[model samples]
Target chain A: MLTKRIIPCLDIKNGRTVKGVNFVDLRDAGDPVELAAIYAAEGADELVFLDITATVEKRKTLIELVKRVAAEINIPFTVGGGISSIADVSALLNAGADKISINSSAVMRPELVSELAGEFGSQCVVVAIDSRFVEGEHIVHVSGGRIATERRTLLWAKEVEERGAGEILLTSMDHDGTKAGFANELTAKVSGSVSIPVIASGGAGNQEHFLDSFTIGLADAALAASIFHFKEVSIPDLKNYLKGYNIPVRIEK
Target chain B: MSVVIVDYNAGNVQSVTYALERLGVSPVLSADPEVIRSADRVIFPGVGEASTAMRFLKERKLDEVIKDLKQPVFGVCLGLQLMCAHSEENNTDCLGIFDVQVKKFEPTLKVPQMGWNNLEHTTGPLFKGIEADSYVYYVHSYYAETSEYTIATTDYVNTFSAALNKDNFYALQAHPEKSGKVGERILQNFLDIK
Candidate 1:
């Protein structure tokens, strides 16, 4: 009875959790370490810190931030963005991050997945696939959705799994920022196709969206950034709603 | 009392070190047999392939070191899996501390039982403060079936050993480092163990 996971993805830019911090109560909540503690205390199943930059120096800041955030929270923490090599992944893991997510780097070098999973474990490697609907086909997009590849979303999902990725963080570019809902059609297709766990990311406007991700999308986990940062949907409140719906979720008391 | 985290190049050692540090315990990460033998407590935390990791342990003779250590040792995730008799993972032979077999979870639901699950039928000092149905995080495909060493049980496609205890060795199938407050309480319990 492994419960479905609810993850709050913290978009970190220049070491701060960027975007949608308008909650009056957390007016001074720019620090990721502070935000992570609050989310972990409020019953977040896991936390993901995505360093939204490609700068080499920003990678250092991201690692430092991971150390600080990890120190304050006990739940599983995932650090992603700009992770390209075994050195980068090992550094983050050494700094206390539980899992490392590789996006564009993984797409550029699919072999990196097997190499990292070889050194570390598949359980510590998360391959995040950012996909967009392109002319009736879901195309894999990389470089934070700025670069589109010819690879099909479902095909790339299978590729990463074959490369020994433990989980897939599938993000729908069209559904992102729209809050309309997650791309359940694509998510369900990928989740059904892969043997590993699938984390449905983006377009999570409400608790119902999360429910859809689980039921319709068949996702093992759901990840959202704005819904959590803006305090529109607290982790405890969301978990409570999901619990009543009979979706198995960890309720931290 | 000194604490040493047995390091065999398996991942998740740093997370466990941080968890121990939060409890005001500084641990030394070492692969030296003497260092591990002399430590007052040892936390064998790991997350990796069983055969690959056991090979590294055997390479450094840590396999024998771990088996012979008389100090209180706590194994987490892959650490627990490696303590069992043998694992279906690569047909790997393990340390045999728990005298049980680790089998791959049947893909009745999901291959990897990822995320939190409740602990039930729990006993022993490892679960002293934790209540029934209290959740802990788990992320693995292989699990040891409930056995004589099983101190805690959980259901995930089947009843499996969540925690096991044999003499001075205690192990958990879940990653307590990532299991939050209840996990910290469990780590504290291990630190307080004589």
Candidate 2:
């Protein structure tokens, strides 16, 4: 019996957790390793550390950070952002990441998905689709939503699966910072079309939002940043809440 | 007294290495037959396609080395699939350690069984203190059919062997290294095997 996954994403800039992270424990709480451990203890199903580092030298630091986090947390780990080639995937997987997420590059060269899947297996590849509703339809966005492509969201989802991607991380740009809820409407369209697991990311404000993502959106996993990062919603409390709704989740004993 | 993680072209060996290190066991990650056979326990972990990985193993004759290993051998994910008689992953024949066939999960239910899932119908020492329905993480599309080697079973579209036990060779579809406490406990139980 597979349970719904709750993934807390940590955005790393220059090898350290950026934006905001709860320092609930430890002397220096900003470290991704500390945060990963805390999240693991809090019953997070998995952890995603997005390395937002730019430049050649800084990427090396991100790799080192990945190694530290992998050693600290025993749960499934994913590293994303700025991963463009097989070499990058190899480096991260070698550093102990269980999976690697490809966003812009996946949209740029869809073949990269199969290439990574061939080299590292489909289970290790995740194609993250950043989509925004434009002109009455969902359109794929690239370069962190700066430019929109003509690619239809549902079509792209199917393409990635055929190309050998194991999972799809569907993030709604409109709902991302708003926190109103997940794009259940768009998510259902994509999730229904694909056979692989779909992770509903962005716009996770409350427990009900997560419930909707799982039930209405039909997503295998739900991911959020601020909600989990700021301690506004603790994972244990949220999992208990979801369990009350009959959502199958792994609760701490 | 030694534990060695058999390394081929598998992807997620580092996590397995990290998991062992946390248990205070410094495991040697190796593809060499000598290092693998010499160890008290050998963990054959993998996260790749069946045919390609088999080619890598066969190229170096690691396949024979793995099959000849008399020590307690544990296979994970692709390793489990490859240890079976054949796999639908690439219509490739496998090492035949488990005497079962690996089939692709029907797309009607979902391809890869991602996230944390529980193991049921549990038995054997690998499960030990781990209760039935104890949640562990899994990420795989191909699964081994339930057989005499099966120690535990789980269902998605259909019930499959979540964990298998045959003599000294043990294999599970789940990634115990990344499965949190229950996972750690399973690994610890494997380590405690003497």
Candidate 3:
């Protein structure tokens, strides 16, 4: 059976982990490679490294960091943030990234999604959509959800899938840091509308939130940042908890 | 032992190379016929479209080289699909190393079944120390049907060949490089194949 995925997303700035990760075993918490290895050992289904780095010159740092992580970590990881062009994606994949996720770039030039899916195959192209429930409808937001776009959340999701994106990473801006719950209504609607797998992101405070995301949200995967980083929920315990609910999760032996 | 990962336009060969490095073997990513032919073990790893990959392999004449390899040759993901006789992906004909056909997954589930799934009914040297229900990472829309060559199987939309073994050629529908410790053991088993 295809197990529902449990992903731990790490924010990267200047090649170092932006949020302070509280791992007792980690000597250097800022090292993304070590944190990634630790997560893989603890049974993370996959890892996502969102490069929050600002400058283009320092982007090389992320590439080097990707290489180190790929060499050390055994599981698949996706590299995102500030990736707009084919060259940027080429460099990251060459540096050993299994997949690459695009956001604002795809919204700016939607053809980049098709181009990437054509060049690298859709299996490696993940389109991340940040949306927020505004007024009466869910609106698409870009530039790390700071700016709103003209596109509706559901239409954009369909468009990216039509453009050959293999997966969709849907993050609810309204629920991101709230710790209340996932945007289950939006997630369920998008997941139902698209044939590609949908990964529900944001608003995970406890193990029950993840369960809600998979069950109510209809997400194929659930991604959380602060919870996994702060050790609020160990992956094994989370998987075990999910298993008790009959959610098919991969438990590492 | 010399290990070579057949290189063409396939995506993400670096991960497979790194996995071998973790197993203490420096693998050469080469499209050269002589280099691949001379290697003690040849890993045919691939990611991307079937027809495009087939085009690149034919242009470089690696297809014939791969078809004739006598050493223990392992194929991963798209590599496994391309080894089959035909692929429903792009309606392309593959190097007929394995007697199976690749078909697209039905839309009842996600097109590209991406995530970890455990291997069942696994038997053969490649699964030596690996436990039953050991999960491996997979990301592909097409899968090769289970056949006489299937050594292991996994259930997704339906039962499909998780791993296939026929003579010196072995293939896995999953990415062993990205499958963590269970994947490490599978790669190590391939290395230990004398």
- For every candidate structure, what is the RMSD over all alpha carbons to the true structure, in angstroms? 1.5, 1.5, 0.9
Native RMSD of candidate 1 (Å):
1.5
I-RMSD for candidate 1:
1.1
For model 1, residues A1-253, the per-residue Cα lDDT tens digits are 6899999888889898787765565646788888788888889889898888657876678878888877778999899988889999988988888899999998888999999988888888999999999899999999889899989999999999988898999999999999999999999999999999999998999999999999999999999988888878888889899989999998866
Q: How well is candidate 3 docked (DockQ)?
A: 0.92
- Please name the candidate that would achieve the greatest lDDT relative to the true structure: 3
Query: Across residues A169-192, which tens digit of lDDT does each residue of candidate 3 receive?
Result: 999999999999899999999999
lDDT of 2 at A120: 82
Model 3 CA deviation exceeding 4 Å by range:
none
Q: What is the C-alpha lDDT of each candidate?
A: 0.90, 0.88, 0.94
Docking class of 1: medium
**Better candidate number, 1 or 2, judged by lDDT:** 1
- Evaluated with DockQ, which candidate comes out highest? 3
- Per-residue accuracy of model 2 over A115-206 as CA lDDT, tens digit each: 99878878889999999999998999998888999899999999999999999999999999898999999999899998899999989989
Model 1, range B86-116, lDDT digits (tens) per residue? Answer: 9999999999999899999888877778889
Stretches > 4 Å off in candidate 2: none
Q: Worst ten-residue run, lDDT, model 3 chain B?
A: B5-14
